[model samples]
Target chain A: MRAFLSSMVTPRALALSALALSFFFMMTLGGPFYYLAAFVITSVFSLLDMVGGQDNSDNDGKPWYYANIQAYQIPFAMLWFGLIYAWYLGTGMSDLFGVGGFLKTHTGFDMFAIRARTTAPELITGGYCLATIWAGFGTTIGHELTHRTWSKVAIITGRWMLALTSDASFSIEHVYGHHLTLGTPADPATARRGESVYHFIPRSTFGQIISAWHIETGRLARKGQSIWSLHNRMFTGWAMTLAYAGVFYMAAGWKGVIIFFAISWFGKCYLEAINYIEHYGIVRVAGTQVEPRHSWNCNQRVSSWLLFNLPRHSHHHAMGDKPYWELNCYPDAPMMPHGYLTMIYIALIPPLFRKIMHPRVLDWDRRYAVPAEYPLIVEANRRSNTADFINNVAPAE
Target chain B: MFSKIFGSATKPATVTILPADISFIVEPKKTVLLSALDQNIKYPHYCRVGSCGTCKSKLISGQVRELTDKSYTLSNEDIQAGYILACQSVPKTDLVLEVPKLRVE
Candidate 1:
């Protein structure tokens, strides 16, 4: 019983289980207000960062659960997707048993539907709630699945989730481009000093797609296959998105289409905002090596629990295939002031972001960066207009 | 010491790595990972100093000499499980290897 219970309650499993709660929240509260509620939940987690652990390490032994966890989650993620799809389309059993209906039955009053708010406003939030599901857990699930090299199903399903976000080529660029060139000028995914979410999003979105295109083209080219071959992953990804969009059009007309893009737009921004903060201002030589210091890490327990220790990012970079439950908190890696959720909220205000993170970046340089790499670090700061802040305040660089 | 472990004097050896299903002959005395990088074949690695264990691979069918000590770097079970650190080992004979598909750059 103990082993059985332990297997079911692993941190990785618990983090994924949090996805169902988001759906429940949506079902309980219809319209744009649910987003407000979700945002507050995130804010509360953000404020609790003070007590979060910084040096937690994974336990040495793998639970019997590790083998079957992915197999278990795939169906769960799919069903979660199905429920959100039903709610958004206002179709099938969801037409009566959906968010509005659920509220009416549960509380004996449906404030949203009883008050009879206009479709335009409800639809606006309806789209947002749907997208929130995608970014919050859908993308997280996709990220986990895409890491499996042996399982084509996991890869395809992961890409399928990303395509719903209109980012089908994430695995291609993520594996070949971002990983190969992280913390360097060559990796467009690495947010430079002074690069805000607004600025980073467009550049990363376009650059990643372009990088995936070139990377895929070259890969196929090496095999003597044409760029236009059915093997082109970039084309296949975009085709998947188009097909998904077509399904939305047929189901709910222009309103559904609008909702799809809106949800995708917001989801992509959420995804990129997390990216913007993850590697902000860190630089490494293009082809040299990667260490724990290249990535910024946080260990706020709530964020770790919710995101399955994604905040323990230094370990992720160093041991790429290590499961989330197995990731360690490296003492030497750069630390974030708050959990990922709160830090993302902080990133919206560029000045505060610089105030907090710039000093940390410079400190990482002093401790980990070699003397030969100093020039590169200095140049990166100068190019980003952060040198003055770094030089003036850092301990006698 | 590194050059001697990965220099021009020794006989070149073939390394066959999978998931990619590609094989290539590596420079004499060079770490199998260095040769992979030179060929732009993607292989996992972190902290080239034989820590992090990111480059750990299973030696499917070959002999390798560890340039760095594996006593502390790899667990005894891993060594018994046929795992070799690609970044710290040179093939003594033609080799076959397997790795988990994971993140990279």
Candidate 2:
């Protein structure tokens, strides 16, 4: 009974509850103010950084409930999408083809009345809530599922979730390109030393799409398929994005399309903000094996619990196939001074972020970087235009 | 250890490295690259996903179940030559493979 009960409340399982809470919060509140309430829920988790502290526990044995944990999120995510858009459309059950009038006749709960109550400020707050929840929940699950190369269902579902954020190509570039090139100059996702989050966000965002395009085109060329064909994942991803926008357009007309783009654009930026945090100012030689030291590891309990142990990034990069539940803690890896949400909040302020992170970067260079990487580290520092690489180096003729 | 000595019902497939003749047992449903890594075999690998072709090897004999499409990373010529990504390949039967390079590290 103890084992069974423990499995019911594991961190991974508990993480799914946030999605449920957000879904219910929006559904019950029935207007734009629900988004404000949802946003407050997300903010409360940010305080977990200080309150929850660190979790260094190991997930050595797999429980029976493990297989269904990730798969279950798909339904919640899909339903959340339907529910939020229904509220925005003010049609409720009407969008469900014939069921709309049938339900409206039976329940007499008019969604048209609720839509009248939604103010512009409330809608703007809804956009913020949509972006944050989608960024935090949708992308985290998407990242996990896309890595399940063994399951085609997982890949498709994960890609669709990412498509909502205008980053379906993450499945390709992240797995095929960024994972292989991480912490090197070739990795666009890696935030270079002295580069602010504002600078990193756009560069990483565009760089990833361009990188995914090259990978997809090269793959298609090898298979003797045209770039325009259905086999082209890049085009297919864009099609999925369009299909989602079409759904919005049909429901709420031009206002819906505008809101959809707003949600997607901000969600993409939030996703890039995560990328900015993971490997900021870290460097590794191009050919060397990716070790635990390459990423900024955060084991803060609340972040780990909410993000599905994504905060344990050192283990994720070291073993790409390992599930989030099984990601081990590496105490020696470079530590993030704050939890994931705190870092994202801090990263938004460029000057403050630099002041906090530059010292840590220098410490990493001194303690972790090997002799072979000195030249690269020195060159990176020079290019960053912040501090000089103060460590002594044996000059070669 | 007991499972190895007694031999489990779902028998693990044995992979014999070509020329070098180093043999290792891959547990059922485990990928070749990961099983080899578990035994501390220096099977040259960078990205364990089917993304990098670093773990590409010639399948001299035996069948394997590929987790992802090898054509994404492996060249057409390499695919035609029965080259598989060890990182993505799970051994189905006892196997022999020609690994191009084994890292000394």
Reference-based lDDT, each prediction: 0.69, 0.79
lDDT of 1 at B85: 84
Measured with C-alpha atoms, the lDDT of residue A90 in candidate 1 is: 46
lDDT (10s digit) by residue, model 1, range A7-37: 7776656654674565555544555655564
Which residues of candidate 2, in runs, are more than 4 Å off? A10-19, A38-42, A60-64, A90-110, A388-397, B1-10, B103-105
lDDT per residue for candidate 2 within A38-127, as digits (tens), equals: 556457767766688888887635463664565556547654654455445644433534334544578876555666676767767766
Q: After superposition, how far is residue B61 of candidate 2 from its true place, in Å?
A: 1.2
Model 1 chain A: lowest-lDDT 10 consecutive positions: A90-99
Q: All candidates' TM-scores?
A: 0.72, 0.91
- lDDT for each residue of candidate 1 in B1-105, tens digit (9 for 90 to 100): 654644333678888877567788887777787788788877777654354466899889978877644432466578778888887787777899987652234
Per-model clash counts, in order, read 4, 1
Off by over 4 Å in 1: A10-22, A28-41, A48-55, A60-119, A387-396, B1-105
